[model samples]
Target: MDVKLTEEEKIKVLNSDDIYGIMQKILLRESKIDQNREHFWVIGLENNHRILFIELISLGTVNKTLAEPMEVFSFALQKRAVKIILCHNHPSGELRPSEGDKDITDKLIQVGIIVNTEVLDHLIISTKSYLSFADTGLLSELKKSTKYIPQYVLEERLKKQATEIANKKKTVEIAKEFKRNGVDNETIALSTGLSIEEVEKLRVRKR
Candidate 1:
């Protein structure tokens, strides 16, 4: 007896993998945040076939900073994705959507509509479990009302933004101090994890 495989069957076989497990594995590989890291992730699907799971498209160390759609969608567009599932983890282990999260999700959904891609769901994953915005009917309501922003997301975004801004300021200060102390751009870059261009900018600013 002989066996043959069809093209569609071959494709399905090649793509056969646990989507949730794959996502968890990717998340595990990322740099573990302190008690406060804000992460934005997007999972792409093509005609009900999951293609990719991306993490930290835009991220911050604290709560106040929000992830932008452009950052999130850049990878999706690169992958030519047709549908998306957005997810973020709450370090606090709270599975509730914050105002900023809701606002961003709504904006993303609108953008998805404009770009002909569907925003299938937004999930809030904690250490142990997950909450789906669509499961709670929030997605449908957002499309209809367009006036809701959960407080949690806003707080989270603000925290992240504050942390990121503080880190950037610290980097600039370190670069300036290095320049003032007769440190070369290369040395400063190596010591501070900053680019040579950034160190050059600091040198120019110092002088």
Candidate 2:
């Protein structure tokens, strides 16, 4: 059977990776840390045939222990994503937005605009359901006073900080800790928002 694809259908198929679904799966696996983790969902939206379905770009996670926008948006930019829908699972299952979540969304929306992308929605998802900041009119308020930061500038600052951290570690044990835990230089670069060179320097010091 020959199937004729509508333009909208074509786009959906083209971007059928289902990033949100993947995020849901990841969150389910991380149930142990559900109460303290934040997940970022970055997606791209293409306007074709007057329909907008999200294209999966990348995913990042921030624990209550480490919430960093640099780590989040870096993946988005790497994916060349044109839009994003940020989501985090609330282990407590409370469908309310926290102050910190609001603040981060505000900053991300601003950054998105500066980077020529759109922050379409921020969702707080639980096992049972979800909340959409855009649908609730919260995003409209945030769009009014968004502060823009260039991606390159953010990356440069993160690189310097990572380098500093690497410089301070003066033990083979710390380096081995990174390697034994399956934390290679590339993983360290991603986790710390550092450059590969900096992570390599740390590895070299260990040897």
lDDT agreement with native, every candidate:
0.67, 0.58
Which regions of candidate 1 fall more than 4 Å away from where they truly are?
1-21, 31-35, 53-55, 146-207
TM-score of every model versus the real structure: 0.56, 0.50
> Which runs of model 2 end up more than 4 angstroms from their true locations?
1-23, 31-36, 44-67, 146-207
Query: Model 2, 52-109: lDDT tens per residue?
Result: 3322222334433234566556655665656666666665678698877788888878
Give the per-residue Cα lDDT of candidate 2 at 170: 43
lDDT of 1 by residue, 1-207 (tens): 011223332231122133334444445555666335666777776775645444455565556546687877777787788877787777777878898888888888877866777888787765466777877999897876444335675588689999999998898888888898788889999988888887777644344
Candidate 2 has an lDDT of 0.58
What TM-score, to 2 decimals, does candidate 1 have?
0.56
What is residue 174's positional error in candidate 2, in angstroms? 75
